[model samples]
Target: MKVLIVDDNQKALVIAKARLGKEELDVLCASSGKDCLEMVRKTTPDLILLDLDMPDMSGFEVCKILKSDNDLSMIPIIFLTATDDTTNRINGLDLGAVDYVTKPFDPFELRARVRAALRTKQLQDQLAELNRNLEDRVEQRTVEINQLLNQKDAFINQLSHDLRTPLTPLVALLPMVLKKIEDTEIKKILDLAIKNVGYMKNLTEKTLQLAQLNSSRLQLKMEKVDLKDEIIDTLDSLSSIFSEHGVKIVNNINSPIQVEIDKVLIKELVHNLISNSVKYMKDEGGITIDGFQNSKDVRISITDTGIGMTHDQLNHIFEEFYKADNARHDRSSSGLGLSICKRIIEKHGGSIYAESQGVNEGTTVHFTIPL
Candidate 1:
């Protein structure tokens, strides 16, 4: 350890150096606070023995300056004073002095105090090093995780595109094959094959859309959109399913509500929520779509008289490929529909949640988008 002893009295400085000198330590002497500050900048000692009274600067001022500096603040300081009064000692310690050695000092006690201060400073340096390494590791891991996610998205896009090419020719030929066959059982089997192909196509499309939405950078084509018109258009598109299920949709939003949004994405969000409720609904059940606005946001809700979900099912409803037993039995659902809806809403700086009254009662889906 290298210790710098600072005092205006050269004799006192020499005495302090002699007392703390040992085979393992080197002692540096300074006649004034200014000399001490300069030597500290040139060679940063492990610890300092500072005298409170000096011609140019007081020890209190020197301690404050050292403690405020980024590089020198970690070096422990031991104040050497003539009188050990409570106020002087407190004032010195308050300015970051680690220990005090009074004049007419015991040589053995001074050496002990210097040893303890160096040990404390060593621990502090170790802790600072550990913190720096931890921060670097966390930053590196974050970059690695982001890179892996990008690769996964690229793979999903390629897989989805490749999967559709072969299906197109097979889909066009299936109908012709059915017409060429006269046996009723053979025709039914061909129809089933066509249905399964359609299901696969839908699953692929949904997967591609989900991957795009979850990418790190998502851009929206923003414009002033009439939400009522969007909802009406979506309902018309799904009119066939509504009729087949004996489902009626009631739109309570009468006004032409204009909102800033990406029209295509909002339409998809509405379609997914409405279709999801339709799938679980009872015969002759009804669906209601409503909207309201506050100062900072707009809220939209879709409520249905459907076979509602249990607590556990609702908890995992928005998770990708998470489905209740009924949904698992359903051929129409890819289990990605609700997941897509949630991602779209969140991308618009919005939130979505589901509410249900146990099983077989009803369910309501609510979403909010920032204004």
Candidate 2:
């Protein structure tokens, strides 16, 4: 422990330093308030023995200054004064002095008080360190909980979408088999039921995929892939859908960029973007697929001339189950397509973002994957 003995009386300072100095402690002495303040600024003592009456500055003023400044506030101060009045003790305590000892002090009592003050300071310092550690642990736990919740939501959505995909064939076949011998009214009711079942199945599958993607469990079998070849393959797979929707597929991927990624996941990403473009187009909009390679990354963009989003809508377009207010009325979608795209991109250690010039203008989705 480091202790500072401050008093105008040189004899008293010597007496206290001699009595308290020990093998485990180092002692420093100051004969005036100015000298004490300078010593404190130079090296902060763990404990201070201050005198109440002084020529220039009272011990009360010194205590007040030490307590007011955050840097010096924790140094334990014990006052040594000749007066032992109740009001004087109260005033010292109010000024943040920890204890008071009378002048012509007993050496044993002074040593005991010094030990007590040092012990209290140690305990207080330990408690403060413990509180800081506890706060750090709480912050870490909060971050972990938030991550888990996001994963849970993603899983539920993926399960629902996957289960719904196989139901499509059943919905169509069941009603056809039962309709042959039914009357016109019965057939009409069956048709309505079949239609609703198909809708439900589509919704379920999309929701499940969204959930799985968001959970960070969407794994990919990675391989070295040529960007041009992959784009051509994806467009070929969706040629029929494009024709039916009267939408044009324009490819400008001139660069022969090679990257390591999951081919199947990339296919799914392209399919979703193309499908969204067709679904939202008012007048047979075209989709442009393009890519370029920079020094450290490959950039891919999907631009569409469809019903684009507002700035606010673009901000949250990738949030799972987050359907725009306007999009909610369109029963054909379950609002998980873009979120799935985002998850797939992120799983590849990439980033995706959308930009639009408001509704009915156009939208461009850009992503960057590290090489």
Off by over 4 Å in 1: 64-68, 83-94, 106-109, 172-186, 217-246, 253-263, 292-299, 327-329, 346-351
Q: In candidate 1, which residue pairs clash? A: none
Each prediction's Cα lDDT score?
0.88, 0.84
In model 1, the worst 10-residue window by lDDT is: 15-24
The Cα error of candidate 1 at residue 260, in Å, is 6.5
Error of 2 at 354 (Å): 2.2
lDDT (Cα, tens digit) per residue for candidate 1, span 161-247: 698888898778888898899999989999999888878888888888898898876799999988889999999999999999999
Highest lDDT scorer: 1
Q: Model 2, stretches more than 4 Å misplaced?
A: 1-173, 176-182, 216-220, 324-327
TM-score of 1: 0.81
- What is the Cα-based lDDT of residue 214 in candidate 1? 88
lDDT, candidate 2, equals 0.84
Residue 185 miss distance in model 1 (angstroms): 5.3
